[model samples]
Target: MEPESYYFLEHRQDLWTFIRRNPEWYRYLTRDTERINEIDQLAKQYFGKTIPQRLEKAQHNIQLVRMLIDMAGAFRD
Candidate 1:
């Protein structure tokens, strides 16, 4: 099956909490080295965007991934 993205309803609240608390750390943990390399190869796709905007997108992706992991753990409980 395809992996879930933003699939855990229960983790939404906690995800928001962590994001609000430490956005930078949240993003650092969620970074996709491979995709980052791809984006670096073509930053023109996201040119004119501020660092904050880029960080927000990365953070959102990270939070969604984390939420899915948390949901899987909960499911196993």
Candidate 2:
């Protein structure tokens, strides 16, 4: 196989803009999703569920981070 090039002119700018605007997404991509696995392990060790009972069994932990992510995705679409 050969290397790919970013020479698709129509998509070049859109790709650059999307990448430049989403540094956090890049950060998250760099982060190990194993972090979720770690959280899972903790939940299993402490209790017997994948999530906290107080948070999940009760009201959802609706926080700013998730809300912002959803809102941004909505706007993008």
Candidate 3:
């Protein structure tokens, strides 16, 4: 086994989870353990764990509320 693969099996549960969740990156990540952090970022992005995604979701919710309020106002009028 490659040293990196062994290291992954022995010491990196987070990376293992990342791999399990995103199998497409398995080969690339296993071949280059140096990219583990990059994979971590990808996982955050994929699962909407990043600030930008969260903010976007929040903004969308705000817009939805504003639209609903406007519709309610129109009904009141």
Best by lDDT: 3
Sorted on TM-score, best first, the list reads: 3, 1, 2
Candidates in order, TM-scores: namely 0.36, 0.21, 0.61
Question: Where does candidate 3 clash, by residue pair?
Answer: none
lDDT of 3 by residue, 1-77 (tens): 36766575457666567777778777876577677678778778877879999999999999999999999999998
**Highest-scoring model, TM-score:** 3
Choose 1 or 3, whichever is better by TM-score.
3
RMSD of each: 19.7, 16.8, 4.1
Candidates in order have lDDT scores of 0.50, 0.45, 0.76
Pairs that collide in candidate 1 are none
lDDT of 1 by residue, 1-77 (tens): 11232333124554444445644533543563233334332333335255777788899999999999999999999
TM-score of 3: 0.61
Rank candidates, lDDT, best first.
3, 1, 2
Q: Which ten residues in a row have the lowest lDDT in candidate 1?
A: 1-10
